[model samples]
Target: MYSFLENSTDIHIHCCPHINKRSTDIFEVIKFAEKNKMYAIGLMDNFSNTSGYASLVKKNFPNLNLKIFGGLIMEPPAGGVSYENAKISLEYSYFENDGAKFISFPTHHTRYIAIQEKRKLDYIQACFYVPDSGPTNETTKILELIANKNVVLNTGHLSPKETLTLVKAAKSLGVKKILVPSNNFNKTTIEKLKIHNVYFEFSYFFVSKATEVPLTHIDDESHKIKGLTLKTLKDLIEAADPKNVILSSDCGVSILPKPHLGFYQFIKQVHELGFTIEEIDYMIKTNSKRLFRI
Candidate 1:
């Protein structure tokens, strides 16, 4: 287990057999988490309904040795979330839904550069429903459902302007939690999301490229510790209380390094970039405890 992660427990990661991943089993993930000294791990996978062998591991392995939780990758917005739509979201098992929508929260300056420079419009569309849900009755119904439970309202793919509007609406409705994961990252989006006091998810994907890596740059050095790196992450911390930031591995891809190294390497690099250990700990631990309600 990585000693670095022991200090900053991680609560978000994708570990599923349904997908062709290098680290495709619970044993591997758990061992890595422990070996790396990562405090914990949370499971989430796109189009999956269970952690496959995770339950078996949990049943056989649940203990103080390490911590593990389940999560899901939700549908992209195709239309505004109505009550019916929100109900659908709630129906997903933690393995595939977690009531967290995979989308961008804003549309202005934040992600425009990434979109224009890297986002594949056609590929992204095929993967998710864009302009999926507009603000309408569907939106109200969805918000109301989330407001009633410990659901997480994530502005996954929306842009800056869209993020502001969507986050404000979700907050007003009293959704239990709000998240702006990787897809919602950008200067303007982070700036706007910080205003709502929502939790922001950070991952090692930004540090190293991997399959389906949504975070890529013009070159290797650009995504390095400096430059446009985790600007959104830093901004989120500066904008909100440190306890509002959360951490994730976003690992399990075939080409990326094992999650253990990914988690530690992320810290090593970010620290080299000037983030303090306490700040990092909050992003990986305290912040997620409140956001995921674990």
Candidate 2:
């Protein structure tokens, strides 16, 4: 057992398994969480409402000792990036236990796909567009819904410029919590996110060789940290500074180690790289709870 995580209120996991062809299912993830005594675990299924599954697990497995939350990924499968679809997903699980607490921008259908596929400057799906100028009437509708619902919004795979625009719009809409899934931003962008009071997530799985995650280059050396080396990620984290930074295991793929194990390894590696346990705890534990309010 990883004693460090036992009943640890400082460790929160963002992408726990059993969804999207992952190695483990909701039930298995719950067992893992219970065994490890995690603080909280987030369930995110691309284009589907998996919070109900998390709700069911919590209902049936009353003895499981961990907090499990769920969210919706706004993609084609979940009816694209439309306000109506986003509302439906929000209402679908909003009444269950803690409700669906998260709503992500397009993930698989963002500019990340264009970069990953080496395609022209186009999104994976043209349903929604977050222009460099800012949110449009259609985009504002979704942002307003997110603000009204008080759900955490993730900047899913959008380019830095687009993400900054979206963040500004979200801030204008009075969004409580805004999370960026990557650390790939320039110092200016990082400062901007901080100014907007957004949470910047640094995922260990992205840089893990076992996961083979794809990365896009940015102007800063820190933005190029993804998929480079763990030390580079460590450097990026240090450079990012603390405050709203968060540490999460975007681990679910079969090729990588299990989420809990991989996260433990990440913490250990970072500690060895010079970060103190208190600093790591703040990212995994404090910032997570603060973001999700769990």
What stretches of model 1 exceed 4 Å from their correct place? 50-56, 76-134, 182-184, 211-241
TM for every model, in the order presented, reads 0.71, 0.85
Question: Model 2, range 1-294, lDDT digits (tens) per residue?
Answer: 336565443222334433334656566666777788787788766647667766777777777668877777787776667778777776565344355678887766665544655444534445445876788787799889889888888888777778888998898888888988664555666766677778788776666774354332211111222454766666666656655678766666565677777777767776777877778777778888888887
The 0-to-1 C-alpha lDDT of every candidate, in the order given, reads 0.55, 0.68
State in Å the error of residue 57, model 1: 4.0
Q: Across residues 39-107, which tens digit of lDDT does each residue of candidate 1 receive?
A: 567766444423333444556765746766553333332222235534554544334434332222222
CA lDDT, candidate 1, residue 35: 70
